[model samples]
Target: MIPNVLTIAGTDPTGGAGIQADLKAFSANGAYGMSVVTAVVAQNTRGVGSIVAMEPEFVAEQIAAVFEDVRVDAVKIGMVANADIADAIRQSLDTYAQCPVVLDPVMVAKSGDHLMQQDDVEAIRERLVPRATLITPNLPEASVLLDRDVEMSSLEEMHASLEELRALGSQWVLLKGGHLGGEESIDILTGHETVELTAPRVDTINDHGTGCTLSAAIAALLPRHGYIDAVRQAKKYLTAALRHADELDVGAGHGPVHHFHALWNNAPLQLQGAQR
Candidate 1:
């Protein structure tokens, strides 16, 4: 059977992040995708203009409907706008506790728009983080989650931040270091053990939905493979997706990575280390 992955997030009209990006990543990684919309945003590659949050009850119903009919292998969650929506998502995951979940604690958009309310951050911390199998956080999100500044000055600091985030109940933490100023980007995976994956930083302003894509790819790979194996696959997949960043023209500003690069080119996904 095809692995089914579900994404609970807001809708991005420009298809860079949110549900759109999750679905794209799932498909690119050989998983079938579904979505439960929490909010609808008038956004593009440039920025978000406005947002309309759906009722908590409606979001619950959408998740229930998918769960009732589909054998969802994993879930990727992003962009829960308010506490009510976050609570609803938490309840749904509680209802189906066996599914592996990948949480991308998306606090702010690449355009610097606030995707979540300040008060809801605690709700996500207290209720959602513990339930997630893996939490993917960049340096800024890591700072917010740990309630301390994460200095990205060195690889050692990045590993320290990953360890701090792992203490926050996630079975694993993929601390992304793309925000750090460097010629190479390093993402450290900390859980049962620590492993670092590095890639040459493609200096492009077109990286819009990178975090969303990474987390979703990891979620899609988890059920079929072990945690460490899936993380290795996800890192390899994301590196190629980043390398092929120049192939798309989805929007006037900050286009998404070329998720379909493998399908078009038929290149093998390469991993830097052993697959678990």
Candidate 2:
């Protein structure tokens, strides 16, 4: 059976990040995608301009509505704009705690714009981190979560942070080392065992939604794959997406990775009025 994976996140009209990217990654990973919007964000490949967060009550209602009818096999959470919404998600998700949850602690955008407030960080750590089956945090996010002034830059540093991150209550923590300067990107997964997932870094400017895509891919794969296997497969998918990212001509600034790179083999789009 196809896994029913749900994404609880903000909107990215550009289809590169947030809920749009989550849905695309879910489909590419062979899962049925569902979504509950938390914020309406005005963003593109360039950057986020503005955001309007949904009421906490409405956010809970949306989650309740999906759970009351559908079988949510897994969930990927991203960009909860504030503390209240995070609280609402934490509470709303309690009833269905059995489903696997992948939490991407999205604090900043690719453009270096802050997507969440400083205080909101605490709320996520307190409410969501403990509830997550796996928490995927890039280097900078890990620093913020640990309240470190500088980001962890070396493999030793990443390994050191793993125990501290796991102490926050997550069953597993995948610390992404993409920010490290190297030809290979290494992500350390710690929980049942320590595993290093290494992929040749795809050098490209179009990595706008890489974090969102990775976590969503993991969530979509978790129902069928084991913990370490899911992380490995998700890393493989994201690497291919990044490698093919340049094939797309989306926008001026940092663009998005190709979520459907494996399936969409450069077929020309059919124009409405063009001759065949």
Candidate 3:
């Protein structure tokens, strides 16, 4: 059966990130996607201008509604915005702890706008991180979680930072090295073991929704396959998505990666089934 994945995140009106990006990534990666919006942001490739957070109870209701009807195999979480929403998500997931949860610790947007509050980081670290199956954090987000400056100058420093993050509670930690200046981007997956996956950095400035897309892709692939295989496949999918990032121009600034690139190219057929 096809896996069903749910995303608990904010709404990106531009459809480049948050729940919109998660759904697109999930669909592209062959999983049925569902969403529970925790907040809504007025945003685009330019930047985020305003945000409207959903009440904690309302967020809980949305999650309950989805879980009541769908058999979610995995979940990807993004931009909770505040502590109340984070707490609500933590509580809701506690009851469904068996599901594989991928936490994309999104603190700031690619356009340099804060997506999560600084005060709420501790709540996320304390309440949510321990429960996640995997936590995907870029260098800056990892720094915030680990309370140290992540040195991008060397791979050893990066590996050490990832190990420190792994001690925080996640069963697995995929520390993204995209922020490190280089021709190639290396993402290290460290948990039971460390695996280094690298992709030549696409020369495009459009990487707005890459994090959301990556985590969503991983969530979609994990249940239908297995964790290690899913990570390998998801990396390839993300690299292809990034390569096609320049095809479409959605906004004036950093735009989204093309999540449907494979489908557009008529890729090899897999199990053509629907998740219910």
Candidate 4:
């Protein structure tokens, strides 16, 4: 049977971030995607207007419903809206303790909407981070986790953040450097091995779901590849998605990365983006 990947995240009406983007990335990487939404967001390319969080009981029920029959090869988690939701997910995930979990701490949106509460932050750091096989955090989210400001502008800072992130309970940590100013976007991976993956920064305002795309890609690839290879391949996928981001004019504000750009294009760069 084909690998079945699961994403436990919130809803995105814009289809760029959260479960929408997660499913797209999983399918793009050749995985059968499943989702359990923790929230229904009233959002668009412009920004998040409001959110209706799912009840903790329903979240647990959804997870049970999926695991009872389907065999999930990997799991990606995003945007736990509150402490109750976090606890519910953690308890449900405990039943399937052996599965590799990809945790993307979705604290804020591209347009600067706070997706998580302060209490949820503590809950994730204590509950979910320990269970995650891999934790992908951007600079702002990393800062919140470590309780200190994190800047990845310098290679030294990147390495430092990677170490601290691992210490926070993730078996491995991927610190995304897209927010750092540079000619290239660099991501640092630390835990099993320390390596830096860099890609030429795509000049576009339509990178609404880049983070979700990347973490979901890693989750999809982890069933077939080691951490390093999975991260490398995911980086390549994200770069291509970003390169072709302008192809889809989804909204007036920050749009989404083209998740299926590789499947559609099959151009040389689609495979060679991460290496360059």
Candidates' TM-scores? 0.92, 0.97, 0.93, 0.94
Candidate 1, residues 1-276, lDDT tens digits: the string is 689999998888888788998999999888999999999999999998999999999999999999988898999999888888888998988997578999999988898888888888988887789889899988888878877764466677887666568777989888888888689888888888888878788877788988888999999899899888898888788878878888766788888887888897776555587487
Write the residue-wise lDDT of candidate 4 on 1-276 in tens digits. 578999999999989999999999999999999999999999999999999999999999999999998999999999899989999999999986468899999999999889877767899999999999999999888888887763446667878667668888889999988888779998888887888999999899999988899999999999999999999999999999999999888999999999988677765445545764
Residue 74 CA error for candidate 3 (Å)?
Answer: 0.2
Cα displacement (angstroms), candidate 3, residue 43, comes to: 0.6
Quote the lDDT for 22 in model 3: 96
Arranged by TM-score, best first: 2, 4, 3, 1
Candidate 2 all-Cα RMSD? 1.4
lDDT of the candidates, in the order given: 0.86, 0.94, 0.87, 0.90
**Candidates sorted by lDDT, best first:** 2, 4, 3, 1
**Candidate 2, residues 23-82: lDDT per residue as tens digits?**
999999999999999999999988889999999999999999999999999999999999
Evaluation by lDDT, superior candidate among 2 and 3: 2
True lDDT of residue 212, candidate 3: 94
Cα lDDT of candidate 3 equals 0.87
Which of the two, 1 or 2, has more TM-score? 2
Cα RMSDs, all models: 6.6, 1.4, 5.0, 5.6
lDDT over C-alpha atoms for residue 182 of model 2: 92
Indicate the TM-score of model 4.
0.94
